[model samples]
Target: MQKVEVSDRDWKHLLDLRDKVHVPGSPAGSNSNPCMSLYRPLAERTKPFVLAQVGQSLDGRVATPSGDARNVSGSDGIVHLHRCRALMDAVIVGVGTIISDNPSLSVRKVKGPNPIRVVIDCNGEIPADAKFLNDDGESVILIQADDVDRTINGTQAVKLPRRQSGLDVEDILGALRKLGLNSILVEGGRRTIARFLDAGVVDRLHVAVAPLIIGSGPNGICLPPVHSLSEAQRPKIDVYNIGTDVLFDCDFRHQYQQT
Candidate 1:
């Protein structure tokens, strides 16, 4: 990836933001700052790619203590995520995230073309009334592992062969490419992001760090042994400030190539 230098003042701003956002007291409190731990620069690539977009607290918690979405990030941060989504070709999430969050995964309140909604449901058990199934305008693609009933609620279903673990990342990417998706935004729930990072399939990462710490609960990403931070070499990052939040945009092209 190409390199661009950030001014010293901007770098200091990022460090300061990271320090202030991670409050050490209550789960619900103001003055909490979240920092996006992006792994690469955004303007250095020119390939069909994947962008991992996530929101996390100072302590790395992606959700509230009870898994509720009450205050993962403030209104500004949430809107920022939607804005990023508006620029991508598609928005993707894992099956677990779909079941838990029941998110529409669309770009709302942002002026841009609506990205296609992509769900990685290894199991063919998506709820019949899931919001994506009935969403207007945005195309929904459900990647499942079986040929189970596809006539449910007018949603498009793409079947993949079942494996003990889950959907194959390579096959999924290929399919997305076939759908004319040049860039994909992975709005994940930990496991999915970790899997892609571990597989070395991610091209870029866009993390929004809020100035608050959940202190505990689920993390933003979870990788296997091989993809552990200690094992995998660190990628480059380009930091940007949006509102009171810090955005860490990272890319990892030197270590691996898209197959």
Candidate 2:
């Protein structure tokens, strides 16, 4: 984390960075804004570039005990999330997020083409009228187990081998990559992000922390228990302050995960 805080003065530069996000030789290559730093590496990828994003409270709660996670992140954080979606080929979430948030998962906050909206529904739980599945000019993919036979109308289903954790992450990525969705965002509830992290498939992790603290609720991440701290992960991280929240851009590739 850099000690110097990024303020409103950097907002225009940040927006400029967002505009030319994936262009390798663009002006973003010469800039030092945290926005440019957060995404430049993952941009323009030929292979799979998986990024997991989460918006949580200070104490690391994604939602309250009552499941009220409506706006944990303020306006700025919300825009930042949308900016992330704009840069990716697709934005992914689990069925829980669909049932709870019913997010459109489109690039409404920024001026960019919308990415494919994907939902993981291993148990055939998502409804046909789910917001993500609705047509909004972008493609939508539903990932499920092969035996689940059911389909959510209008979505392209990609069934993979189901494991104890869920559908295989590698197969999911492979299937998505085959469709040219190389840059993926795992935007979700806790378990889905944890599953990807545990699978060692995530390349980067964007954790946007809002100012307020939720004393008790579901944690942002609930990974498998490790007896000792030595077994824990210590990825290289970069920090950015985008008004309402602090973004921790963690580089998991080559640190531990197989990117």
Q: For each candidate, what TM-score against the reference? A: 0.76, 0.87
Candidate 2 per-residue lDDT, tens place, 15-54, comes to 4444444333544344465545665555545567899999
Q: What RMSD value applies to candidate 1?
A: 11.1
Q: Using alpha carbons, what is the TM-score of model 2? A: 0.87
Alpha-carbon error at 249 in model 1, in Å? 1.0
Tell me the number of clashing residue pairs for each predicted model.
17, 0
User: What is each predicted model's overall lDDT from 0 to 1?
Assistant: 0.68, 0.79
- How would you encode candidate 1's per-residue C-alpha lDDT over 1-259 as one tens digit per residue? 2222233333333333322343333322211322222211221124677888788887778877677755577666676676556656788898788788888887675444577888887767777778777767688888887755554556678877766677788888888888778678889979888878877888877777789977888888776556444566466665666665666667676443223
Best model number under TM-score = 2
The TM-score, computed over Cα atoms with residue i paired to residue i, of candidate 1 is: 0.76
